[model samples]
Target chain A: MRIAVQAESFDLGAEANAFAAGVAGAGAVVTFTGVVRDLPEGGLQAMEIEHYPGMTQKAITAIAEEATQRWGLCDLLVIHRYGRLAPGEAIMMVATAAAHRAAAFEAAEFLMDYLKSRAPFWKKEITTAGGDWVAAKDADEAALDRW
Target chain B: MMQVLYFAWVRERIGVPREAVETEAATVADLVADLIAREDRYAAAFADLSALRVALDQELAEFDAPLAGVREVAFFPPMTGG
Candidate 1:
């Protein structure tokens, strides 16, 4: 498993290829990328991401470990960005490899679900009006129940 | 001395990111009470516990959790990570 919490942007294609190539016996690989979207009014200037340094890594590692143990993943890669990012920028990506497509897809979804609520990162949206912290959604928390 | 940290609006409201807090508080709730009594900013920040979350020694924890050996405590709003 490889986990990176960085401020710099990453190439999605390169990352996906690297993850797939490293897992020799894996038959399936799934990659999911999250991108920033403009607000309804379309005035979003930037999204500032704040995270707890030590805790952020620890939380994500734990979540990835659980995914590996439950799904018998051959490999997994998680890369999350921090700091300010404009709309349309990629925020993060998760790639999972397994012997079958089912495990790869399911583990990828599980990682995304846990990362949404459990990771120690907060986002503040800056727009023409002002900056506002993005509130946590009940649906995001509820999504965990499926796992 | 415990390392008390705040994030997001909690840090903004309290006007500090982290501080060294010397306290005799037994539980996380007691530590919060002490901070609330220190200044209005702290009181305002901690006014609604339901809107807040706490971590003890970098792990998610409840407000009533004991702080006997905890060296670090953090307060922040619900995480919106993805």
Candidate 2:
């Protein structure tokens, strides 16, 4: 298991390949990447993500540990970036490997659901109108109930 | 004395990221009540407890959690990570 909370951009393909290669007994692998979305109304200049440094790593590690405990995952990787990013830029990624596809897929989804609300990162969008902090959606919170 | 930390809009409103707070509060809620009493900035930032989350010693915690031996406390809005 690897969890990286960083400000530098990551190569999703490279990371995924590396993770898959390093896993010894993984028959299946799954990867998910989150990207900064361009607003439909346009003028999204950038997104600034702020995080609680000490807690961010700890929380993600705990979440990953939970994912491993609940599933038969062979390996897991999580990379979440902070700092400034532009629209269409990758913000974070998660990859899971397991002997079977079901465990790999379910663990990846569980990681995402927990990370969306539990991680200590906040996002602010800078647009032509102004900058505004993204509010945590009720739906996102509700999404946690499934797991 | 305890180290108090704020993040995002909480830091923006409180005008500082962290501070050493001298207090006699017994719990997270007590500390917040004291901060709200300090000035309007804190009062405004803490006006709605439901919108805020607390952490004691870098662990997510409830406002009513005790602070007897906690060395650090943090306040911020709900996380929008992922």
Candidate 3:
């Protein structure tokens, strides 16, 4: 299991390949990447992300650990970025490997759902109109109830 | 003295990232009450506790959680991560 919390951007395809190669005997690998998106009205210059320095890594690691235990995952990787990101730029990614596709897919979705609300990061969208902090969605919170 | 940190709009409202606070408060809510009494910015930021979340020593906690041995406390809106 690997968890990285950094401001630097990453290469999604390369990282996915590396994660797959490293998990030798695993039969399935699933990867999900999150990207910065523009607003419906369209003038998003960037999305500035802020995170609690000490807590971010700890929280993500704990979440990944839980995923591993619950899914019996062979390997997992999570990379999250903190700082300004332009629209279309990759923000973060999660990869999961398991003996079968079901565990790999389920674990990846679980990781994303938990990270959506449980992580310490916050996003502020910078549009031409001005900046606004993204509000926590009720749907995201309710997603946890499924688990 | 305990280190109190703020994030996102809470930091913007309080006008600082973190500070060392001397308090006699027993719980997170008590500390918040003292801060609100001390300054208008704090009051505005903490006006609605329901919209906010607290972390005691980097772990998500409740407003009524004790602050006895906690070295750090953080206040922020609900996380919108992922």
Candidate 4:
């Protein structure tokens, strides 16, 4: 499993292909990319993500390990960005490779779930009123409990 | 010594990213109460524990669990992770 904490956007095709080829037992590679959406409808603006330097990456790596142990995943990659990000930019990516699509998909989802609830990251939304910290979403935490 | 972390609004209210405190907390809940009672800033930051989540050594944990030899504790709002 490969986990990355970076500020730059990534190419999904290259990452997916690499994961697919890396593991001989892998027959499927599933990925989920997160982009900054303008609004409920569609608009373009800016967003900022904050994270603790040493701690953030460590936390994510541990989450990836958990997913690997639980799902027997062959390969996994998690790339999350920090700092100011404009709309349409990729903020995070979770790619999982496994013997089948089910394990790959579950691993990807589990990675995301643990990352969301466990990692130490915060977001600020820029709006007409300037910028403010994003509130924690109950659904996100609840989603983890279900797993 | 236990390392404590504050995230998001909790960080803003507490005015620090992290703190190392010496404690003999019997449970996570007791530690929070001690922190809030330390000062107005802590009180304000931890005023609403309902919206907060506690993690013991980076894993999500319940409040009533014993602190024991825990080296790290973190407080943050419910996750909005994808």
Candidate 5:
């Protein structure tokens, strides 16, 4: 498994090919990309993300391990962005390679659900009124409950 | 000896982010009470335990739990994490 947390955008095809290279038996690979949106009504201000240096990696690694356990995936990659990100920027990516697409897909979704709820990152939103630290959305917690 | 840390609003109320203290108390609640008795700021900071969350050794944990071999305790609002 490979995990990367960077402020740079990644090439999906490049990552997909790289992940599939060693697959002597696996015939399927899946990739998921999460991009920052530029929706007009999105009401996004400047985004400030904060994280604990060592704990962030520890948490995400655990999340990835969970996905592999549940889905029996061959390999995985988790790439997340930090620092100030504007709308339309690439926020993160999770890619899974497995013998079958079903395992790959399930592992990918599981990783996201766990990350949305458990990772230790806080977002500060700057609106026209002022800046406010974003609270844990009920929807995020709800997302994890489905699993 | 242990170091207690408060973040965000908790820090704002307590006026300091961290403090080191020795305690005869065996649990997190007792430690909180010790801080609360020190100042009105501590009282306000810990006014509602229901509104707060604690992390022992940087992992989310409960306050009613015993504090054995724990070097750090951090308090913050509900994890608004992603």
Candidate 6:
């Protein structure tokens, strides 16, 4: 498993290629990327992501460990960016590999579900009006109940 | 001395990212009460417990969790990561 919490942008194609090439004897690989979305009015300027340094890594690692254990994944990669980002920029990505597509897809979704709420990062949306912290959605917390 | 940290609006409201707190509080709630009694900023930051979350020693924890042997404590709003 590889986990990265960085401020720099990543190349999606490059990352996916690397992950797929690194895995041995995996029949399937699934990748998911999260990108920043512009507000409907389109005045969104930037998104400032804040995170607890030590705890962010710890939390993500714990989540990844649980996913790998639960799904018996062949390999996993998670990269989440922190700091200012313009709308439409890639925010993060997760890739999972397994002998079968079902496990790969399921583990990838599980990782995303946990990362949405459990990770220690917070996002503040900056727009022409001002900046506002993005509120946690009730649906996000509810998403965990299915697993 | 316990290392207490704050994040997001909590840090903004508390006016600091972190501080070393000297306290005898037995639980996370007790420590919060001590902080709330310190000044208006803390009081305002901790006004509503339901909007907040806590981490003890770098792990997510409950407000009522005991602080025994804990070296670090963090208070912040619910995470909105992805």
lDDT of 2 by residue, A14-126 (tens): 99999999999999999999999988888899999999999999999999999998897899999999999999999999999999999999999999999999999999999
Please tell me the TM-score of chain A for candidate 2: 0.98
CAPRI quality level assigned to candidate 2 from its DockQ score: high
Per-residue CA lDDT of model 6 for A1-147, tens digit only, reads 999999999999999999999999899999999999988878899999999999999999999999999999999999999999998999999999999999999999999999999999999999888899999999999999999
**Model 4 Cα lDDT, one tens digit per residue, A72-122:** 888888888888899888889999888899999988888887787678777
For each candidate, what is the lDDT?
0.96, 0.96, 0.96, 0.82, 0.76, 0.96
Candidate 3: residue A41 Cα off by (Å) = 1.5
Mark the regions of model 6 whose C-alpha exceeds 4 Å error after superposition.
none
Q: How high is the lDDT of residue A86 in model 5? A: 77
Score residue A23 of candidate 1 by CA lDDT: 95
Candidate 3 lDDT, tens digit per residue, B3-80?
999999999999999999999999999999999999999999999999999999999999999999999999999998
> Best candidate, DockQ-wise?
6
Cα RMSD of predicted structure 2? 0.7
Worst 10 residues of 2 chain A by lDDT: A127-136
- In model 5, which regions exceed 4 Å deviation? A7-13, A22-24, A38-43, B6-25, B39-48, B80-82
Candidate that beats the other on DockQ, 3 or 4, i.e. the better one: 3
Alpha-carbon deviation at B82 in model 3, angstroms: 0.6
Chain A TM-score of candidate 6 vs. true chain A: 0.98
Worst 10 residues of 6 chain A by lDDT: A35-44
Winner of 2 and 5 under DockQ? 2
Ranking the candidates on DockQ from highest down gives 6, 2, 3, 1, 5, 4
Which residue segments of model 1 deviate by more than 4 Å?
none
Fnat for every candidate? 0.83, 0.94, 0.90, 0.42, 0.44, 0.98
Q: Candidates' DockQ values?
A: 0.91, 0.94, 0.94, 0.43, 0.48, 0.95
Q: After aligning candidate 1 to the native by TM-score, how far in Å is the CA of A143 from where it should be?
A: 1.2
Pairs that collide in candidate 2 are none
Candidate 5 docking category?
Answer: acceptable
